[model samples]
Target: MTDNKRFLLRRRPEGAPVETDFELVSDAIPAPPAGGFVLHNHFASLDPAQRGWMDDAPSYMPPIALDDPVRATTVGQVHASDHPDYAPGDWVMGLNAIEEYSVVVPDGFTAKVDVSAVDSPSRFLSAFGAVGLTAYFGLLEVAKPQPGETVLVSGAAGAVGSVVGQIAKIHGCRTVGIAGGPDKCARLVERYGYDAAVDYRGKSAEQLADAIREVTPDGANIVFENVGGTVFDAELMNLAKHARIVLCGLISEYNSETKHGARNLWQVLAQEATLHGYLISAYVDRFAEGGAQMAKWIASGEVVMDEDIQHGIDNAYPAFMRLFSGANTGKLILALD
Candidate 1:
């Protein structure tokens, strides 16, 4: 019998995960039931949320238990099937573990997709999957950007940020993206259509806030927060009247030993800004609606997918580490085959 390699959570991570936090093991493929599908995995989605998933905390989803196969969002090709809805050779994306193969149930997961229509199959996990959905419902549904408003997006050159900035620009909002370096800042403006991009590498939180205020003189109308730490505190101090803050992620504090709390959250009341945090899975029923619109924009060249895929599944740990260090340019993902 052939063995499938999978990554499992050995113990709760102390801070940033090292190889010891996970254990790679080979397992035999189990027999499929009468109506299940067996898939040979290809790509796995590495997200900052996965860090929270490893911790035993009250979150949008349950945390992975010790000795459990590490939970993740992944895409793969069907190798065998018993369900009438699927067949061999069909490409699919869904919530699965980081493994070489998986037995997917028809319920509680997304069906197979046609990857040829988009830039890459990996985009299903990115611009068209969780990232796109996060950008869509968070920015459009939650923030409700109006024309001529100033929108500030943190982690603005990363996976969800790239999409959020583009969507804001599409709505005719003055978009400002905050990233780590100059190259990412440039790409945010030149490629993703942000009105301005700020590099936060050498600047202090206060200086970054000043730069944001400079780009948005009237104060930020919307703050799409992906990195929550001192940045969120600074952004809180610059909110316009009745502004909206959509809390998408907080990668900055993901691996922190001592969690940082928002000190300037009182500014929400002072600035008359509303802060809302949500998970994309909460809006799963409306995915088709958002996906179709995003697809149309992408097809019309209105939205672009800028994915940064690492070469192999073995690179999953390293690729995941990149998110913490701000090493990736766009959607950070792994390609196994």
Candidate 2:
């Protein structure tokens, strides 16, 4: 490839992102400075969090600057190296950008991958990737659910939420997942092993709350919230005393110009619930441990991993739009091959 292809952020989006907000162009491929290496990306992870990073707002990470290739977590092989610890052809995964290559160092999160450790290199972008690790740490470590506790997961059909429900079940808790459509709801129960599933397609926040209450009669002891706005408000309506609400993502509000604060926050006070915002970066030091456990679960029949892989980096825009469109069935990954 002459230089490299990049999907650049042309402008900050007005609402939900459109293709014009980003432009694809060839640019000079950067050389690794001393101690840095170049990653020839093969697959990059698409996530709702990327939408949040598009804006010029304060967030956990800096906003993606205009004219820059969009930020993404990518898995690739070393193309060239200036670092002693890394070499050509070494497989690595890092929080790189949406481009053909990335220049990075051995930051806390970037590390080499053992391709033989998994069936496919893309597995590093799915089950043993960001979403899986997020679910593992968020549910098991953050929520700290006891046996018999009711665990309700929002966005339950998505990559992370599905894993959260399964892990909760493995730990002996009743799992209820709230997803967008009936098909996703069905998969949550039949495919992902949720105890029950709630469809939030046409339901209002109040109605969704009723649906959740019907399934979790005693109220949920833990609310693993991903979809915010109405879905999150609905979850607030039914909370067990001293419930733990893990704030993972706000998929419903990420694209909106007007961000809506939760209307049912009073339920938190009423139920004495504790809501903690979750960031996967917090547990980066222990990814090896989490990846090992997930590998074991996959080797057994305990955890089923799913990926909706789209071929070609040219399809990045449409592939990413799948998350908001509810078209992709599993973890969305863009293949640059």
> Using Cα atoms with residue i matched to residue i, what is each candidate's TM-score against the true structure?
0.96, 0.98
Candidate 1 structure quality by residue, lDDT tens digits, 119-207: 67887887788788899999998999999999999999888899998999889999988888888889998999998988777777788
lDDT of 1 at 261: 66
User: Would you list the C-alpha lDDT of every candidate in the order shown?
Assistant: 0.86, 0.92
The window of 10 residues in a row where model 1 has the poorest summed lDDT is 103-112
Candidate No. with top lDDT: 2
Model 2 has how many clashing residue pairs? 0
Cα error, residue 265 of model 1, in Å, equals 1.1
User: What total of clashing residue pairs does each candidate reach?
Assistant: 0, 0
